[model samples]
Target: MNDELRERIEHEAEKHALLNAVKHDSEADVGAVVGPLMGENPDFREYGDEVPGVVAPVVERVNELDTEGREKRLEVVAPDQLTELESEDETDDRALPDLPNVDEDTDVRMRLAPNPNGPWHIGHARMPAVVGRYKERYDGWMLCRFDDTDPETKRPDLEAYDAILDAIDYLGFEPDEAVRASDRMETYYEHARALIDHGGAYTCSCPAAEFSDLKNNGEACPHRDKDAETTREEFEAMVDGEYAAGEMVLRVRTDIEHKNPALRDWVAFRMIDTPHPREEAGEYRCWPLLDFQSGIDDHLFGITHVIRGIDLQDSAKRQGFLYDYFDWEYPEVLHWGHVQIDAYDVKMSTSTIKALIETGDLDGWDDPRAPTIASLRRRGIRGGAITDAMANLGTSTSNVDLAMSSIYAANRDRIDDATDRAFLVRDGVEKAVINGPETGEPPVHPNHEERGVREIPVEGGVLVEPDDVPPNGQRAWLKGYGSVRHTRDAFEFTGDGIEVVREEDVPVIHWVPADSNHPLRLRTPDGDVEGHAEPGIASYDPDEMVQFERIGFARIDRQEDDRTVAYFAHP
Candidate 1:
């Protein structure tokens, strides 16, 4: 890479890495520096360290998407593009409209209805955190409503639903109850029948091409004039499996001439030929549209508040119309913006990130790059860190794209007070010959006098970081620990001659004896690191988080045998 490109990548990586660090370390200094930048630069355009030549390829690739595909991508890539519809202009003669009142005393029951289409993504995790906060603050319940209306989307791997429930519980947001839309189909059918009987819905037999235009154009169809009795017959026939998939649909007789396109006649229910994972194929022919079903469900369940992403603002409006038509109370809604990490000028999505995990382009979902909750947890990011990050961006209607360094810094500060310290050899190198005292012990942490330190068992031969050693006969000392001297051929071992390097160097890394009965293996950036147990230090428990003295924070992964142990790093 050219200097400019290399610098850009490094800068982006550092910005993202900083958030990971804060969440692990809880660094206040970082917050002081980046907190003010949150809303001041909502677009994050000024942070572009991109080279002039690098813009062409990105522009070219984005241009390849079709119009509808581009619109779909905008929700994730550029949510600011979304525009809300304006209500009719108020005239002086018109009566003032009454808005719904919300207050502390309001019984605000909110819900998060996520479709169990695939594994829960970062987006899914974000919903609960946002909604749960409101519920906790207002003493409300955030119902976990499973939007299983479209049976095709429901998978055989029901464990994904269980995982989300588990994740919600782990995050301390247990729902009051679980409700599946599939089980409530009878209620949806009742609403469809009501609409048909009221002459507000009709059966449309338009082909795909004609329906595509009808969906957006706000143009009436010939079928819209069908009598209520005939329409009701067709709908009941739909219920009784008279229509095939895509052959006929019950559409609401919304104002087709409305300027706001989504307000036009919308599909109320349709036939799905696919099998339901939870039921036999062809058992049910009619399925309610998402907006209609959600509207009815929310009203029936008495959802007093709806907290969701800004991208779904239109969904709230559609449901609002339904509330007006049915004369039901509408819920108060709060639309929070999306979290955008600095990714070298490209936006990221949970689906794309998940694909990277499955394809081995990245590690599992917990991989730091994936941005999933598991990834954040695996990175030693405390829950307080994420909460702090969200708080940094207070509830605002404005959109904000942030460099992740700030959040990482928050996490780092959280773990700093509790982290224990230890020495680590990133790459193996033997220590130089003993020059200071024959034996010495390094404190686990610099300022911690009472916590005590792990003793290093050193002898004539010891290992260290290879890069820390010098050529020829030179001296290196391990700070707090004993020293070592290097010679061309100072020692001999039973294996390859590679073991003959002198054990003395400048503060060479300490290591456990290779022949020790209890050996500890650690996962680091380079690979697994092997060590021996200290004489007095007790074996670490599975969840015990400790600093390897000079090394970083780590949690015990497993106790393989009585003598074998594994450790994984965080942050």
Candidate 2:
């Protein structure tokens, strides 16, 4: 782990230690702090042996402070984490921690800035989802900003601008207005000029390789000490396209000997000769880099809080220099660590997904296999479920692996009652029942009798999964109907034999009558599962969620050629 991540874990451990200290008369138990810290950040769980080493010092430090000092320290580190200390009872840990320093009455403005290169995947959903939750939590306004400035390396697709907004809407957020960085080129230019005049930045003609060598050695560039007037002339010339792409760049002025090489006078703006994908591609050539562009825009747009990934923590430092130059106060920043979805092994990189799509190795963004928001939405995963799962992760700077089961659990509560259950058998084998009922009337849902029963036409020829029948030909219960004995040739069905089914230690299996079964094509993340659905499945309309008894949950997509196409959610 990097020092930054380690530092974050130490901070969390300290917060827990302080809270425990305040709770127990200014002396904290190491056990209390370590348990809660491990719960919040999974990273600590792996390095369990090292946790006590990290926590013992924190516990010692907290015990030195008085009750008042402990409380004050806890408030500074985690403002709203303190519980009501009057009762000395157990405290309720709310699923989502409240955003710190929020004034619910004020117009709290947060933003979702996405580079419009591709549609949002599962990882990208967290930003807008959290922002939307916090927006409602604080009665705040949200802005959808398309960071579409880069046209050469990370080209912006024209469709991705609207695609990202669609994703935000899919997450149940409506940004007050959508803005594009490309549209604010003139504003970026104006600020670049202002920075040169303020003696905060200067144009440098250093070759790219030479600058890298000097920056690595902590040496100043040749044009570092130029007067503001001369820098202004050079900046104007660079902006007016006098400099070819990569010939010159506007660099923010900072300590040349800064400890971090990346922080030493980073490039603010550069010329890109490649035609931008935007309609006004030819109109502008000089584009401000991400740090400079977002620094200026965040102030201009009045964004109060910015939630981004922990990997870009240095961007905030880089933007701070710009903020200092303009004498502007920086917005509150929140960073989250990487989120890995456990269900899919595919990397959640947009560029990687786009390349796979282009190569036809995978389907489009909405493919059942793809982990994009569009894929989930198309598969009938509710927006509320997505947002709730994301909000549950909350704001933690530890690498987390998210299980798809958690998502399924959240969605099950949402769709279980509303969906009707039916019988669906995949890779079915035909069997002749010795005494089968003419019709089977299973309730739409076992939990709700008022929903009524579905009339399924049962006949001698029943279709059941080949695996459901024991190879040893043992007796098994045919669910909702009767007991059956799988023989070498066929199954001998017994009518209403609940006692007989309970007597045998047997598996209860669901079956679709061959005569009444409808063709079904189930699209799942694993792959397509072709099956036969009971006649009851025909009653449900398109986009309706349903449970296939003994199988799993699915959403009815559409009907074509007497076949029902549905998307399988989970088992």
Candidate 3:
């Protein structure tokens, strides 16, 4: 082989070796890398017999590195593959990275915190799905905590609390404990007083703009050196409702010169006068910030592992000082990159959806067009599909746009078996089928025979989708029923068997009896699709998924007084 070819072969070999080793605990196998190597690099075909010899040494080189070392090098060599490897078909059989500092005897505890602002969008499911998986792996405790502290900016919705727990139950990862930060104000106040007495936090009365300037410049405020007694007195006053909104704040005593300016005496608590929707939560004028609230709760509730987003890495740094002051061990932290869903029309924000709903632009949280968990459940996207999709993505620390195709594929796998096949003719054109068969039996489920059949009553005329019509004098088959010859504005029954359409390569499409079918209005993400379906369509219970042959899958949304309605899922 030429020098260029030799270089290419060695480079490819090392790349595959690193990937394989990273996947299998820093241990690579020559056999695993060889097939992918030769298959992807067809130019090495002539020398395929010598490929194993080249890959064996590469495996040795890769196996010499530890797990982190191997993964670090892989990121440098091929970053995208690190994510793709996690999202591959191996998700069903692959294992996640081991939880740090964990053992068989360790008491494992986990938590998922939401603000209770609105229903969880698809992006919001990642953290709980990941933590829930870990909880199962170690038989740990899981807590669903509502971080509803920001009353002014992110006011808590009265209804989202139950909706979130419902989503968790649907995902099959219900937590052992459900809590709200707002309801635990006394606990937070007690901790704040203790921290103040310990000289770990102090009251800061600086104006908002001044604090921003000082924090940005890594300069400590004048109040940082106040005595603990003074700070405690001020904190008591604030808890006693002495300070108005934005008049003063409480900050942790971290290093002012920390390299990351965000860690410079970050706000631990603030005063918000906005009345909370919940009567119990509305009584408090003082609120703890997210970091301080979650930091204290993590230790108090015994949360051992924390699944966090990469954007919030600074939160860990900010909380580390408080842990130091209290002599507490921080929880095991895992930060994954963002999962930006592509090809989804809706913005993945709770506040945005709420605004749209208020403006009459959206129907509700469960609108078929929205991407909330409630919407997904209503649209027949199973909860298992969401969790399984997160498993396939894993915890790779590279922000990648999760393709819509993966979600569709996962949902398709979940619903394909239970879904019964039926016919839905869009923009139907009635045609007289001369001497047509009176009765036809199509399997309710194409893959399962014991499920029985859907009796499609064929009358003298059939309703066919306009798009399925063939040219004049062409043969067509009403799927599973019989063959018919197309005439001018009608069909002539030609044979009882399907062989003619199969042998002659004729068009075959789904059909419904013109006289016996019911009206259907399919509400898809795009818009409403009006059509006709077989009489058996009404037999399905609400929320049951059905496959309209050659069209797509849809969920039985409801039974309108005048028609049957379904939400289109996917093709």
Determine which window of 10 residues in candidate 3 has minimal summed lDDT.
496-505
lDDT by residue for model 2 over 402-432, one digit each (tens)? 7666566557656766778888889998877
Compared with the true structure, model 3 gives a TM-score of 0.82
Ranking 1 against 2 by lDDT, winner: 2
- Kindly give the number of clashing pairs for every candidate: 54, 0, 0
Error of 3 at 349 (Å): 1.1
TM, every model: 0.70, 0.81, 0.82
lDDT at 29, model 2: 46
Q: Give the per-residue lDDT digits (tens) of candidate 3, residues 194-300.
A: 88888889999999899889888878788889999888888888887899998888999988888888898889988888878889877788889999999999999
lDDT for 158 (candidate 2): 83
Candidate with the greatest TM-score versus the true structure: 3
lDDT of 1 by residue, 1-571 (tens): 3666445533433332232222223222212223223323444334322221122222223334454554454445434423210122212112111113657577868898988665554445556766666676667777888787787644333555686777677555789888777778889999888767767678988876796687676667778888999888888899998889999998887678777777677788998887667653337769888888988988888988776678777787766656666777777777777765553221255457656767886666554455566655654556655654554554456665544554455655556566655544444544433334444466665445687866665554455545545454554444455334456633221121211222211223344432222446765433456765443334666665655533445665557755434344432
Ranking by TM-score: 3, 2, 1
What's model 2's TM-score?
0.81
- Which ten residues in a row are the worst by lDDT in model 2? 85-94
Model 1 Cα RMSD, 1 decimal: 13.8
Candidate 3: list runs displaced more than 4 Å. 1-95
